[model samples]
Target: MTLHQRPSLQSVPAYKQGKPAAAGASKLSSNESPHSPLPSVLDAISEGLGTIHRYPSIAAPQLTAELAALHQVDPQHITLGAGSVEVAAQLIHAVAAEGDEVMYAWRSFEAYPSLVRIAGATPVEVPLDADSKHDLPAMLAAVTEKTRLIFICNPNNPTGTVVEAKALEDFIAAVPRDVLIVIDEAYVHFDRSAVRADGVELFKNNPNVAVLHTFSKAYGLAGLRIGYAISPLEVAENLRKVAIPFGVSDLAQRAAVASLHAADELSVRINEVVAQRERMYEALEVAGYPVVKSQANFVWINAGDDTLDIEAKLADGGVVVRAFPGDGLRISSGSELDVDRVIAALASVREGAQA
Candidate 1:
């Protein structure tokens, strides 16, 4: 007899990781920090190797306290997960179940649909606006009695478009108090916009709001897989309940703590990344592509049907970028050489298109 599996799982799509580049090509497929880990972070990780035989602290008390102090929130409101994505999954399970609905912007995060379906909730997707930002008005209109949770990816993945502060605050005020609003601020550090929504501040006044952050992005800790949520005390408690035992490793916890201490160094690195992102956005626009105004560490080119063709050309030019097939392309801001190669590749592709 064939082994039994959950029927819902058969239709669930596996998460697709960014493709790796060949030798000599710059891999900007993943929106990761181009800079190396701070020396202090490296030292912390090396020191943690001494405890290889022991299990990591289940509570991760020290790291939790540091984060609490940093955000000026009660430690009770903080919850750690393997990554923010894992925390998102936990939150979906905590609030929604069979027959319930989880809502988010379509093309916001590729993982949203899979996460909702895994929790046995129906995924309700609202399409993005013409500019590629979340259509919050439409998203709020889609909210039905069955809607339990909504995810708003600020500086949304793949597009790097943000819903400005005033607009976002208004949307929060209008949303039903019972429905949880998850502000996925994964790219907040790179956002230089004057009107960017402060997710942490928003979470404090609104008990129904939860802010998901990841060490994987700004802190250069993708391999370590450490992330956390600033949520209401009850939600935080439930997140802990669903968390995998010994999920945050000793190295990850210590490294994150050290990284938090080196804020000045991180700020300098972040500024450089932001500068590069702006340069890349402008360069793409001048090169004749319809590039979105990005506030994150990546630029989005609305290539539509030409995505694959441009992606192949970029790959041939020793540069790699993430392409969303028929949607567009997402290219991470990297070193100067990487940016130069991207410009050249884009110019070459546009010329070929015209011919």
Candidate 2:
């Protein structure tokens, strides 16, 4: 006999991960930090390894304290999880239930819908405007009585477009005070724009808002899966309730603490990545591709109908990039060598199209 499962789950799609590169290919699929962990972070992780036999502290006290101090918030206002993604899932579970609605911009983070579905909450996706930026006006209009939560992926993944500080603040003013708003800032380190929303500062002012951060993207700790959410005490308490026990490993916690202390070093690395991102953006623009201006470490190419074909061409040229079929291509600013490969691949595609 077949085992019973939620019928709605049948429609849920598994998260699509970046494709692996072939031998000698540059992997620009995942928006991972091209650099290795800082030396201090490595040393910290090494020091923590001897205690792996023991269970990791469920509270992750040291890391939590470091983050709290960094954000100038109480420890009670912060909740740690395996990653910001997990923290996001926890947020959904804490406040949402069957029939509740979670709203976010469409063509945003690919994981938003999946997380909403997993929570048994309805996903209300408001489409992005022509510039591939969040249409805050439309999003505000879409908010309904059933809406329990909303996600604003600042420096939104894939597209890498950002909602400016003023626009974001105005949108917050319009949102219902009771509806939970999550600012996913996984790529915040890469964003240097003066007009960018300071999510942490925003959270301090807005009781219903939370800011999500991760070590995965800019911190180069993706493998360790450490992230945290800064929210109001009540919401943070609920988030911690749903978090998996010992979710933030001892090694990850220690490394994250060390990472905080190594801010100068991290700043240098981030500047390098930002520089590379700009270089790639210029290259794409010069190559006549419709690329979105990105504040994240990755750039997006609106390849339109040529997306899949260009992706295949790039793959064959030993440059692997994340392709959304007909939508566009998302290419991470990886190593300098990888950026060269990407530009070369784009040139190849352009030549072939002309032929």
Candidate 3:
């Protein structure tokens, strides 16, 4: 909000993040896991405490190596990020020139257009399909010579439907090689579907693509804010060119490294959430509200009703959910206690529907 801020910065809307509820209010607004950290991750963080006085490795080499190994890619193919959001923003800054256009599906991340405008670029948003799915065909047509960047939010935000893998591959084939395509797979961990786009694999031989992932979702480490990108060596080079050094702190780097090692345990926890998501989806669908097949941990409330009424009723009953101006309501997967509260709130809505 500085007077000297660039005009482009003026119209960029603030990102809306979910906050924890008051002292005792249970929070299910943010799409966060209701689980405790792994003991291994805690030990790593505690060990890192001894090195706080020293500056963190600017490159986050140890963590990068681990990530590369896990992804079966060379270390040069990796670039660490504070979070996948940072990696997404870096794509915009690194590729799009002022006045160039950055395109994405509307109601995607909510951050896409803002970050685009911040880069002194124009945002071309293609509205989602009537069912709230990304209109991939429309997005493909939105690109013009001015388009330098495009973000595909798989299992897209607010609406959890993932673009079919074949459609994604065909879309990539249609896009011009000069433009950088970012596959934001923040929720990949919870995806049990075999048909989802594998961005890392998609970018294997392609330099025009970048795959972003984060520990925030399935890793249950949102508080730590660890994420990374896998891309061609040249793409990684360009990302680092615009990336600020030491972007990730010592503690976060240590925690992420520990997390990669605790993979089996993390998978078990994610599967539990996936199971819960299925049960929630079936319950919602059975109750007569339309529910999309969610590939992520959270489910999208069909937005089929007046979201305001649904939101107000839920809040009054002591459950917190995120309702957009559209009919969409994002209900985070929660602990049994939190989930029960959400179910009770919905039960009232269900009755009102039948009334």
Model 3 misplaced stretches (Cα beyond 4 Å): none
Q: How many backbone clashes does candidate 2 have?
A: 0
* Candidates' C-alpha lDDT: 0.91, 0.91, 0.83
Give the candidate order by descending lDDT. Answer: 1, 2, 3
lDDT of 3 at 324: 81
- Cα lDDT of model 2 by residue, 1-355, tens digit: 9999989999799998899988888889989899988889999999988989999988888888888888899998988899899999999999899999999998888988999999999999998899999999999999999999999999998888888999999999899999999999999999977678999999989989999999998889999998989998889889878888888889988988999899999999999999899999999899889999999999999888989998998887798889987799999998888888888888888888779
- Model 1 C-alpha lDDT per residue in residues 221-290, reported as the tens digit of each score: 9889999999988888888888888888999999999999998999988898888888889988887899
**For each candidate, how many residue pairs have backbone atoms clashing (under 3 Å)?**
0, 0, 1
Alpha-carbon runs more than 4 Å astray in model 1? none
Off by over 4 Å in 2: none
Q: What is the lDDT of residue 67 in candidate 3?
A: 84
C-alpha RMSD in Å of predicted model 2 compared with the true structure? 0.9
State how far residue 200 of model 2 sits from its true place (Å).
Answer: 0.6
Across residues 167-208, which tens digit of lDDT does each residue of candidate 3 receive? 989999899998888898989888878889888888885668
